[model samples]
Target: MTNRRSFLKGLGALPASTMLASETGFAQGIERDHFSDIGVKPFINAAAAYSALGGRNMWPKVVEAMEYARERNVIMEELQDAVGKRLASLIGCEAAMVTGGATSSMTLGTAACITGTNEELIRQVPDLRGMKNEVIIQKSHRYSYDHGVRSAGVQLIEVETAEELERAIGDKTAMLFFFFLNDAKGQIKLREFAALGKKHGIPTLIDGSNSVPPLSRLSEYLDAGFDLAAFSGGKGLRGPYSSGMLLGRKDLIEAARLNNSPHADTVGRAMKVSKEELLGMLAAVEFSLSFDYSVENVRETRIVHLIADKLSVYKNITTKVSYPRTESGRPHLQIFWDKSLTPLTVEQAQKELEDGEPSIRTCYLALSDGELEVGAAMLKDDEVDMLVQRLGQVLAPRAG
Candidate 1:
C-alpha cells in the first residue's frame, strides 16, 4: 500500500513553480495553510464529490494551467471561443463552452433556447414577454437544480409519459430537459426524449453532471440527439469546483456565450467563470481523456478489498464490494454489521468517524439493512490506511 508520505512526495516532485507558494514573494518560499488559519478543518474525503465536501481535488496539471492563466490577460470572448473550439473538437461535439458550474450551464443553455441570439430577448430574461416561456420535463426528472433552468423565466411543464410530453409541446415550449441520473425512473428514456424534442422542433438539454469515467458519455449524449448537455468540471473531471462545460448545437452555444459573462444585462452575467477556471477545466478535460481508467479501476478495487479485509476480522462484521447503480462508475465498499454484536448503530458509527481526529466522511443509511458505503475514488493511499484503522477501531467490540 502506498503511504501518504510517498504520495505527497510524488506531488512535491511536480514543478516547484506550480506548488502553492506565497504569491507576493516567490523567492521567500512562504507557505500558508489558509484552511488552518481560518479555523475550518479539512477532512479526508472517503465519499464521492459531494459539493459540501469541497467537491474533488484538482489535478496538478490543472493547477498549473490555472496558475499559468492567472499571469496572462486576453479578450474574454476570444478565449472562450478558442477554448470552446478546442473542447468541442476533443469531445466530438458541435460546440462547447465553460460555465460557472453544471447549474450555470443549465441556466445559460435554457437562455439560449429561449433567446437564440436575439439581443432584444437576451436583455429581457426572466421576463419572457416575447420568448418561449416553457420547458418540458418528466415529473420524475425534476430536481432542485432545475431551479437554474427556471431562472431563465421558463416554467417547467412536467409529464410522465411520451404521449403527455408530445401533447405538452407547443409554441411556448422552449426546450425539453432530462436529468440523466433519473433516466431509469422516468417513463421516457434519453433517446426517446431527444426524439420527442426533435419531432417537435424544440431543443433538448440533459443535465449529466457527475456522469463521467466512461467519459464517452460526454459525446454519447450529443450523438444520441440531445441538442445540449451539461457536465460538471469539479466532479469526475477534478477541475475547479466552480467550473463546468456546456456542449451541443453551435448556434445555441453561440447564443449561450452571448448570454454569459463579458456581456451586461444577462442572467448568466452574474454566473461568471474566471479565465483561470476556464483553462483549468480545459486541462482537466485533456487529463481525463488521457487518463487510464482500467488502472484506476484496479486501484480502487484494491482499496475497497483492503478496507473490507481489515474490518472483516471483527465478529459479525461483513463487507461487500458493489458498484453503484449511479453514473459514479466506480466500485464502493459497503460495511455491514449485526447490531446485536456491537452497541454501535450505523448512524452512531458514522458520527463517531466524523467527529474523530482526522475526520472521515462516508455515506450511511438508517434502514434495516443499511450499510456504511465507502467510496475509494476520492481517497489517497495513506488515507485509505487511516480509514481502515479508524473503521476497525470504531467497529471493534467493547470489552464487557
Candidate 2:
C-alpha cells in the first residue's frame, strides 16, 4: 500500500554494490570456471536462506576472519574451546559451540544428552542399546529436521496436548525437543514447554534457528529453561554454509564437543566443522551482536518497498511490503494479482523468473487465486533492480 514517494526516503542511501563481487574473484581469474567448472550456475537470490541457494552471503568480517585463520596454525581442540567461550559470551549463554549447521547441532546435542562425555557410549550411537533413546517432541513440531535428533540414535515421541506431553515422557525419555520456529503452531507454548522439561528433570532442546532481526530469541530459549539450543550460523548470522551455533549449559556444551569433530569414532565425527567455519561462526556472532538490527529491518523494508513502488504501475497487480506478524521479522513483498485483469498466471511468472537469463528466485505460494511472496533479506542492493525489472517484464501485459 506504500506510495512511490512515501517509500523513497531510504532508497537514495541504499548501497548498489554487486552481490557476487567477492565470489566473482575466483582463484583462477575471470575466464576460469569457478562454479561452472563443476557445471554449477549462479543466480540472484530474492529468497531467504534456502539451503539449495548455498545459504546467505558471509559477513565481510567473517570472510576476513576465515582468510586470516587459513594462514595460521592452531590446535583444533583449543580453537573450538576458545571460540565456544567467546560465542557464548556474545550470545548470553553459559556455553556455546560452533557446529556443522543446525542439524549437526541437533545431532551433537542429542548425543550429549545420550552419552555426556562417555567415550564408549559415543562410539555406540545410531544403535541406542541399553540407553534412554526416546526424545519427546510436539506433534505439530515434528518435521524433517527431527531426523537430525534421530541420527544421534533417539526415538521421537510426538505429542499434542499438555496431558499427552507429560504422559509421553517416561524412563526412556532422554530429552524433550522443541522446534522454536513452529512454536505458534504447537499446542505446548514456549514457557510451558520449558516448564514441562523443568518439571520432568529432563533436559530440553530447541531449534532456535532462522531468527531475523532483533535476535534476542537466541538466548530467550535458554533463559526460559531449555538446557541446550541450536541456531543456524549461515542464515541470519551470515557465516560459512557448513557452520551453526550450539548454545547451552557448560556440561552439555563440553559433552557436545567431545562427540563432534577432532574426535574420531563418534556419531558426529562425520559432521566435521573446519577451522575456517569455526572462525566464520565466531565473527558472524560478533557482527550480529555489535550491529544495530533496527537499521537492518528498515533497510530490508525499504528494499521491498522499492520493488513495490516499481510494480505499482501494473493494472491488476497489488504489492504490499509487509513483515509477517508471527513468522520472520524481516520485511517481504507479497504480490497479489487479479487474474481476470491480467493474462499472467502465478506459476507462469514464477517459472519465467527461474528460467530467465539472470535467473531470480522468489517464494511462489499458491495462497488462493494468484499470489507470490518474495523475501528481501538476502537481496544485494543491485539485485533489487534486476528483480523489479524481471518481475515487471514477466507480469506486464502483452502489447497489441
Candidate 3:
C-alpha cells in the first residue's frame, strides 16, 4: 500500500512559499528588472483589469503555475483535456474549455453551436450560406460585444419580448445569445429566455464575462437550463489576461475544442490559448472558488476609509466611500468638489493624476461637477498614501 505522503509526493505538488511584505507596495523584483530596456514603464493599476491596463495583477499561485507550464512542453490537447475536466468540476458544469479570452470563447462557442462536430460544417462556417445562420438576441442586449457571435457569419435577430423572441426563432435560427450581466436591460430574463430556446430547439449561450467574484454564476447558469456559457478568467479570477473559459454540455464543449486552436482550418485556430495560459486559468479558477470574499471586502473597505479620511480635510470638498456588492463587489472612494471653488476641472484633476510622477490612472466620475472615483481593489497599501497626497495637492487651498 502507498503511504499518504508518498502518494502526495507522486502527485507532484510544489512546496509553498511564505507571504511577502505588502504595505511597501509593488514587489521589488518587478522594479529590479523594470522595463527600461524596452522604453516601457509600469504604473499603479487603480482601474481593476480594464483590459487596457495589462488585465490586472494575477495571484502568486497563478503566476507560479504559468511559469511552471512555460518551463515544460507537453501535448496541448492532453493539457487542455485534463485542465478542462478539473475546471468543470470546480464550476459544477458538464464540461469546460480554456480559450484565448472571453471573446475568443464566444466566437468558438458560437462556431460550436453552428457546426456541432460536423467537420464539413466547421470548415464551411462564417460562410453560413445554406445553414441556420441566425442568432437571436434582445435588442437591449446588443452591446458592442455582439461582434463576437457575428464574426462567425451569423446574423443577429433582435427582439423585444418573449413574443418577439418566439417570432424571431424559426428554421434558420441557430442559437439564443444572452448577456447575463445585462439581464435587467433585457425584457426576457435568463430563465424565460432559456425556456424559449429549449422550446424552439435552439442552443442557448450566455456571455458571463464579468459575472465572477461570486464565481457561482458558472454553476448557476448551467443549472438554470442554459445549454452553454462562457466567462472571463482574467477579470475577477486574476488569471492570465489572455485566458477565458467556455462551459456547457459535453458534446458542445467537445465541438468547441474541435474548432479551437491546434486544429488547423477552423475559425478558432487563430484564437490560440497557450499551454501556460490554460494552466494559469485553471489555477486561478481553483483559487477564486475558495477566495475569501468577506475578508477581501473588509480589507477593501478599510482602504476606502483610509483614502476618504486623508482627503476629507480639504475645504469645500466632499468624500464618500460607497460600494454595492451587487455592482463590482469592491469599495470605491468618490471625491466631489465645487468646480467654482477649485482651480481645476475634474478632467484637469484626472489629467494631473494621470501625468503624475508615477502616472496614476483613476476612474473618472462626472467631469462637469468635479467628481472622481478610486477603486480599492487595485490600490496597493503604500500607493494609497500617494493617491491621498496627490488629490489633496491638486484640490486643496495651497499656502505659499
Which candidate number has the best lDDT?
1
> Stretches of candidate 1 above 4 Å error?
1-30, 364-370, 398-400
lDDT of 2 by residue, 140-218 (tens): 9987778999999888998999999999988889999999778899999988998999898999999877764456767
- Which pairs clash in model 1? none
**If the candidates were sorted by their lDDT against the true structure, best first, what order would they fall in?**
1, 2, 3
Candidate 2 residue pairs in backbone clash: none
Question: TM-scores for all candidates?
Answer: 0.89, 0.88, 0.88
Worst 10 residues of 3 by lDDT: 1-10
lDDT of 3 by residue, 1-400 (tens): 1122321222222222222233223354454554877888777766456677676578777878999999999999999999998887666678899998888888888898999999999999789988889999999899877799998889999999999889877888889999986788889999998888888888999988877766567677877778888888888888999889998889899999998889998999899889899999999877665555555667778888988887777776788776633235577777887666676766788888888777787763531123577777777788988887777777775443
Cα deviation at 113, candidate 3, in Å, is 0.9
Task: Give the better candidate number (2 or 3) by TM-score.
Answer: 3
